[model samples]
Target: MRMLRTTLDHVRLRDKMLLLYFLCVFIPVVLTNLIFYHVTSQNVKEQRMQDISRALEQIKIEFYREFEDAMEISSILYIDHQLNELLELAYPHPADYIAAYDSYLRHMLNNTYSPVYHSVGGITIYTDNPTLLNSGGINLIDERVKSLPWYSKIPPGRQSKPIFVRTGDGTGEQQHPFSLIRRMNYFYSQNGHEKILKIELRMSSIREIFHNLNLQGSLFLLNERGEIEYTTDPKVDTNAKAVAYNELQLPKDTIEFKTNYVLMNSLNGWSIVAAMPEDEVLYEMQTSRNFVLLLTCANMLLPTLIIIWITRSLNVRIHRILKHMKKVKNQRFELIPGTVSRDEIGQLTGEFNRMTLKIKRLINDVYVADIQRKNVEIQRRHAQLNALHSQINPHFLFNALETIRMRSLMKREDETAHIIHNMARIFRNSLVWNKDRVTLREELELISCFLEIQQYRFGERIGHEVQAQPEDLDYLLPKMVVLTLVENASIHGIEPLKHGGRIEIHFELRAGRLILTVRDNGVGMSVKQVQRLYNYMQRQEEMGERIGLQNVIYRLKLYYGSRFELNIRSALGEGTEIRIMIPADRE
Candidate 1:
């Protein structure tokens, strides 16, 4: 029974009891919160999707109109059959060329033609062993057929067919010109030889088609030739951060189908890929989130006030028990009066006081002797710093890191392991005793540690990228200030996410300022949360536990004299990036 009581007490009774209370309280709150939030988000997501889809549908109207117009023009060219008959009659005639050309012009004038958005540049018919000179001072009949797409693949003695043309510079694959091809039969001369007509098309309307979308970010049209006919903006800053484009297993030569909501779109052997500034979506969502958050915040405070009231009342009872405890501390345990209050804290502390009183009555003299026996140990060894630093071997921490790494590996999480190992290396430095200031390398390692832990905790719901130089790692930083953010991200930002997000960490040297950043791909904080961070930093002005962001912020003020700047950028469910500037000093 004694051992059972000891085990239960050591098993963390306060936390376990609090956890039971919290689970009962938080579970209902979370379910209600989640259900309400999910309904709101679903409606918003569906509305946004429908809005975007409506825009796509509107673009399709233009597509059908353009295609119908092109087909209608093709019909007109077919009906203007006299131009083909002129070339047929003009064939094998030199002086007849003037008469034949005049007939062709007369026929062209009779045809109805409207302005084309991107029309055939001009039509020309070629005849073998034929001669005709016109107003241009050039004869189309004598011109030899050179390079044309499907020129050879085309079947002989058949109607002209649509040709797949490429826009090329015609010089090298490195220097290519933009071109479009559309082919049809205008005329074929009657003889052993054949004269055929073709049109070289200009895609000016294609430009207008893309432009009308008035998209906000990168928009492109990719056709079967891996040709990018249009791009509103080009990517030059970062190469595809995941894989080389050529190495990607993306759908070959077409984006006609897509499974991911945020993936490329394919249509008409051409796909339109668009990326709008995510900030816009987040900005819009913020308006609603602010309202919800205001309510959430209002609701969240009520419980907090209640919990505070409960904690205060509980603390009062605890203080009463402690008052009796202090009196007994000067001597041996002495019995104290038990409280009439039936509350849990009152009962528990009352029992504790009673037990101490009994022990004092039984072992006052013996306990006094035992106290003297331990005095020599404290007097002979007062090296608490050495003991505190050295006694805590990093073996446990390394093992913890190793456990996380090995577990991630077994689960086939390579990226996760990379992050975890990086974090572990940072902790290796952190736990080292007698280390007041870590170099930039060590500081960076610390940041890496925090990032990996966060990356693991967040999973694919978050993305992260880091850019840093080795020189910066040698600069001194207050230990663990950056690392504390990892915990902050988990405890504060990420705890609310329904689907996870991205973090970007960047360091640069600019105008003597050493810039450090930590960003997260989690549901971002409310303005209140953002405001609370400042309060948290101030709250750290009071002594606190070593486990959270407040503790780390405290250390930062100690080292940097509060002259540092921490700039933040974020949106709900969008993500966050924090950039901090500090003077670079190596010691």
Candidate 2:
């Protein structure tokens, strides 16, 4: 079953559809034709059997007439008074008795009964009387009479009923002639005499019944035990070699005619059976079958061919659409041509064409729009840097000038010159805002210059430290991004303490990400204040302020999308820590 399922799964839709059609149409048609042939053949066979039976009946009628004539002659002789008296009278002399019997026999054989029926051959009388002579139509009974097969069968109670037997050759030959025998009895005289009358019929009488009969079959005349008495087939000699009814090997079709209906006073269970071969009986049916098969083939072939053609034509169009969809999967948008028909496949093709066009247009529009948007974002970040740098420049110059004036009054000319140089370098970095990005080393150098200026202004009260891996020094970030974070921690957290606090700047690499932290120990701000500042950074919006930190957050968002992270931690009188994480692989 699993193998069958796998085979079906691999089969294409066209083959599956064809298989479905075969089951729905051709298989049923073949089955129906088989059923039709079976039913028709059965009906034809039954009809042929009926025809054979009717023919047998007609033959039966013709043969029974001959048998009836023989029966009629026997009945007439049973009541013949003259013939009986002649046999009963006592003869005083042998010559006179013989002469009297010859005259009576001649009269009966030549004029009385023989003239009535032409089928009878000869009639003879066998008697035990001593006066009777063994002449023509007369025989004296002796030892041979008791030895005869019909001698014991003759009725002895004066019934005068006839019995049929085969008469052997009188000269002891094996040739037989059919005969009927009857026992004769005295009516009045007490002569203690007995006589047996035998009438032989010509064998030609039985042969004439079968001659020129219009039938091609075998015929059997069966006797009391259903044994064959006679058969029209010359090959069968039932008298010498008998055959039983069941052993006849009769054909499938047969008809039987019984002798009881054909012969009056018939005591034997005799029947005339006729059998014809099945092939002969069903000749017409075979012709009809051949013609039906031809018609069925023509019927099945033409339509099946036409249906397959149509199925393939429809599938071809569907497969064409499938090929187009495959090309679309590879981003090759091409249209199907001349597919606008009224059918469902045509409609699908039209819809597919339209969809490909829409997809192509959508991709082009989004592509151009995305490039333009990236250019505008870069220009905006550069503008924000310039504006922020220009705004912080004058404030830094005022603080540096005041620090230089204080150092000069204390007579520290070298420190004043160093402060001036650091301030000048800070201004130089601010002026070069054309490049939106710089290496971490460059940004750290600028941060160092800013810290030196601040240290000169605050003296030993303000201390700071910077630590970073040498490998991280070459990593690129937006210009002054680190500097802004350090500046914010100093101004907001460290400078608020009366005893100035220390600021620490650390750069490290962790888990393929760059981490920059700026921490200060001073009077820390409240949680509410830190929360507000972090929310403002996330929203990138503010009403009354455009702080440098906000600018840094916005530029970081633009450069790295969502790949950078910033976190601020602060508490009252403890410290503030700001940690920023960015992708290590960033430019």
Best by TM-score: 2
TM-score for predicted model 2 compared with the true structure: 0.51
Worst 10 residues of 1 by lDDT: 257-266
Q: Write the per-residue lDDT of candidate 2 for residues 306-364, one digit (tens) a residue.
A: 88898987898999999999999999999998849888888899999999999999988
Candidate 1 lDDT over 341-375, as tens digits, reads: 78777678778877786776678668777888789
How does each model score on TM-score?
Answer: 0.39, 0.51
lDDT of each: 0.55, 0.74
Residue pairs with colliding backbones in model 2 are none
Worst window of 10 by summed lDDT in candidate 2: 167-176
Error of 1 at 52 (Å): 5.5
Off by over 4 Å in 1: 1-21, 24-27, 30-64, 91-129, 134-145, 148-155, 167-188, 192-202, 212-298, 321-587
How far out, in Å, is residue 185 in model 1? 5.4
